[model samples]
Target: MAPHPPQSRPSTGPDPSAIDTSRRPFVLIWEVTQACDLACDHCRADAHPARHPDELTTSEGKHLLDQAREFGPGQLVVLSGGDPLTRPDLVELIEYGTSRGLRMTLTPSGTSSLTPETVHRLSDAGVTRLAVSLDGATPDTHDTFRGESGSFEQTVRAARAARDAGLPVQINTTVCAQTVDELPALRDLVDELGAVLWSVFFLVPIGRGRVLEPITPDRAETVMQWLSEVSDDAPFGVKTTEAPFYRRVAIQHRRDANETPTDDDIGRRLGITAGDGFAFVSHTGELYPSGFLPESAGTVRDGGLVERYRESELFQSLRDRDALRGKCGACEFRHVCGGSRSRAYAHTGDPLASDPLCAYVPDGYSGPLPEGRVSGD
Candidate 1:
């Protein structure tokens, strides 16, 4: 008479549209090679000269492209590497991505001068844009960070070459404690180079960067303030993603002043966030949910790209609240910020832990937040 009824469980089967939904991935990053010429201090890609089978061949790359195309039209593909330019087959790979309705882009170290012939090939291959990494304002600082002499010269040359080739060029700099004091010079450099946009990302402590503390709270604020001031007079538009609150306010201020300038307009118009507009594929063909996250969802060689991502628990978890831990649940800015999963894992040694970087934000800033608590688990 006291026997209890059986408990029931809810269905958790996969949704058919989960892979092909347009609302999900707006862009994808394919790391064709981890073989790089220069060794940067803060690089998380671990891109040193090493013998690894992660580099994709022409057929393999095309197979990945075919899988990516299943996400539907207008998805952007970023061809990255330890240095993507080092690959001789880069042009053909870019062509393959573009031919599949993926707008192709690349991120290069700028260690070697991009040959005019190569630039022409890239143009013919339909490479839409190129982003060159520039971590410091002056030659001494910039070249030093890259761990090579004369890198600044080569980078500047490459930037000019990309621009002259009719490919839009964007400069990406990491705002660390070392470079925090040089915001003005950085802006000037952007202007001098005729860059389309200046993207400043916070230095995430991961990989080789784990040993160093990037910046303190006070220093981060100082850098933010300086960037705000410099961007006011900048001819080229400035945009930042990692530093969300400060950059959001800065962009709004400029927009309110009737400034029509914008960065990643295609992404903006499409309502794509930094992570959504891009997915980083490792050299071994394992597709990550985003560039920085360590969780490998699946490999491109597994099968059709769309089917693999669809079956990925890690990929799905990225967009789902159940996958988050601790403060991310209640974070006020969870939607806009999405928080940095990779950053959380690296700093605290917990993938689901709250981002330690939040400690840098000032106390009085008004904004939405995700879960404001953290866990050691």
Candidate 2:
């Protein structure tokens, strides 16, 4: 099927460029399952091949959907998993969530289950968009990284099928030391697949992800610079995940090039950072600041997700940029670029610690180093 004309960029809420901080956290990522066929090297959930007996049932899923509605309308509930498609009741769950006034999206590990018929069913079930991961530009590299031969082919086929089914498609690519060099080719593939958005997720060491080495701070800065330059001409909108500091880098680049930055630019800077504007619910119903952070705030079984989000000290502390440690706490762009809490926690065992992969030294930071500095002493 020929790619459908690109639709206006899809967002869970109002244009992020004009986001209201008072009404933050308009997105909830729900891990619907912990079972997937592939054993990706960077799988954050450490998924198994069999569904956990304690996974949420369809009734519990419906209750969760009802609770999610309390976050307000236009809120995006991203149903993700080891592979959400692994669940037979996925379509039923999607329909249930959407029927309750929540906009839904899906993030499925690309596998045989993502056939054209499955894509059509998902579309019919009210999924606004589908995000599929593509880590490498070539099959050999991607397949090996996924720990499943033929995964690359399946992913490409799924992307095509999703578009053919008239479902908006977003391609998520992980950027690490290994895949950094292949981004240009991956960008080409994204364009070829006619994806509407390309999300670049910088590696955060956690679960199975701890085994893969992340790129150095200097290399990360260089890659962001490259992304900032090429994004202007790319066919799809570009965003970064687990790398909120890219906003500061992008704004600085624009200013260096003599462009006047606007409040919209700054407001748009508030991407899905942990606790501030994002929430994660595990398959077992445990609530977290983010899927990456894995710090439990509460569980859906206790009920009142909105209350738990508001009352959790962890969430509150995360939202308070002044509580951040090291360079991040002292950075002039603290509000706009709070750095990655997950990466900080992974490297220094402190979620409030400065992200080690960010090379930008804050403007007025001359204080003595924090006790467990992940960067240079």
Candidate 3:
């Protein structure tokens, strides 16, 4: 593990982190395929049983990886999918990205395809991490959520295999009304599985995810507070997806605890929401600010990936927090904890609108509050 070369950040105004979104993104997720073995209840992809006929060819995928490398050395290239294993050339793609000096990560669905051999092959191919979803502590709850029996057992086995293969594992959990109560249990499992990180994803209503119930703002605040506590004691790091307000809650908690925050405070508090420091390329080359956000800024078929991210009007608007509406625009923490752009789009049609999942209301606000905003004066 040689230390990664420092990213050549041009300027640091999102200063505490020194990650300049204008030049390159911190993460670029490419949905390699929309094909999957299970129909999970909260799947943002609404995946199908087979890959699309118009999916990017292997050469096209390599080209996309090359474009992603322009972000600079150590750029994270996540090969996400409905199930990347469904593709025959997954290892080939992984090896290509590794050769480009990009830190490649894979998020394959839990299934028979995630065999020990496959895990080892991916590790040998230079995958930086293996992210697997485990929504429940018990088999019944997890299998049901995945809409497939035996998925729970399979997922656990794959995680252990990843660990055995000497690859770092990241446990991903879906947090919503259905699974919120299981957070404490999930944390134990994350530790048992030797995961280095627990990525808690709060559900945004979309695709197959629309049917799942979102947690109310007040409840969300409580969960984040608990998570902040969990982060302090848990051996593995905890981070929220689609819930940037967790950073606000964590920061507040630190102050209340009389703890001095680190310069990399916003590192795990990554909220570089859609089109800001995050970008997603769908299986068909459609470019989105996030996998949870369906709005297309441009297609890879039309122009360069980096060009679209830096120049598109949609990306430009999303990156501009001053142009935000409601509490998000007025909040002093807008630069670092600008709220979840994907959640905002899920609530209101406008991506620039306020994220409804956050309980915080800036003082002296006089605009229409988000639907289901915490009840208070």
| Pairs of residues at least 3 apart in sequence or in different chains that clash in candidate 2 | none
Superposed model 3: Cα runs more than 4 Å off: 1-16, 256-270, 371-377
Q: Write the per-residue lDDT of candidate 1 for residues 1-377, one digit (tens) a residue.
A: 54222122111212322433334465677888888878888777878776366577778878888877777665667787788887877777777777677777788776754655555567667777778878877789999888988888878887888788766888988877777667678778888888988888787776667655577644565566666766667777676645544533444444552344333121232223333444677888777765667676666775646654555665555555445565554544444444556677666665555555554332343343323422321
User: Which candidate model has the greater TM-score, 1 or 3?
Assistant: 3
What is the per-residue lDDT of model 2 for residues 204-231, given as tens digits with 9 covering 90 to 100? 9998988898888778888888888777
Better candidate by TM-score, 1 or 2? 2
Q: What is the C-alpha lDDT of each candidate?
A: 0.64, 0.82, 0.84
Candidate 3 lDDT tens digits, 1-377: 65333222212122325667866787899999999989999999999998999899899999998998776767888899899999999888888888887888999888888888788778877787899999999999899899889888888999999999778899999998899888889999999999999999999999999999988888999999999888888888888888888887888877642344443243452457788888999999999999988899878964589888899898999889899988899876677677889988987788998988887777777676765654364
Q: What's each prediction's TM-score?
A: 0.79, 0.91, 0.92
What pairs collide in candidate 3?
none
Prediction RMSDs, each to the true structure: 13.1, 4.1, 4.7
**Better by TM-score, candidate 3 or 2:** 3
Question: Candidate 2: worst 10 consecutive residues by lDDT?
Answer: 2-11
Worst-scoring 10-residue span by lDDT in model 1:
5-14
Q: lDDT, candidate 2, residue 17?
A: 56
The per-prediction tally of clashing pairs is: 15, 0, 0
Q: What does the lDDT come to for candidate 2?
A: 0.82
lDDT of 2 at 277: 81
Predicted model with the maximum TM-score: 3
**Residue 156's lDDT in candidate 2:** 92
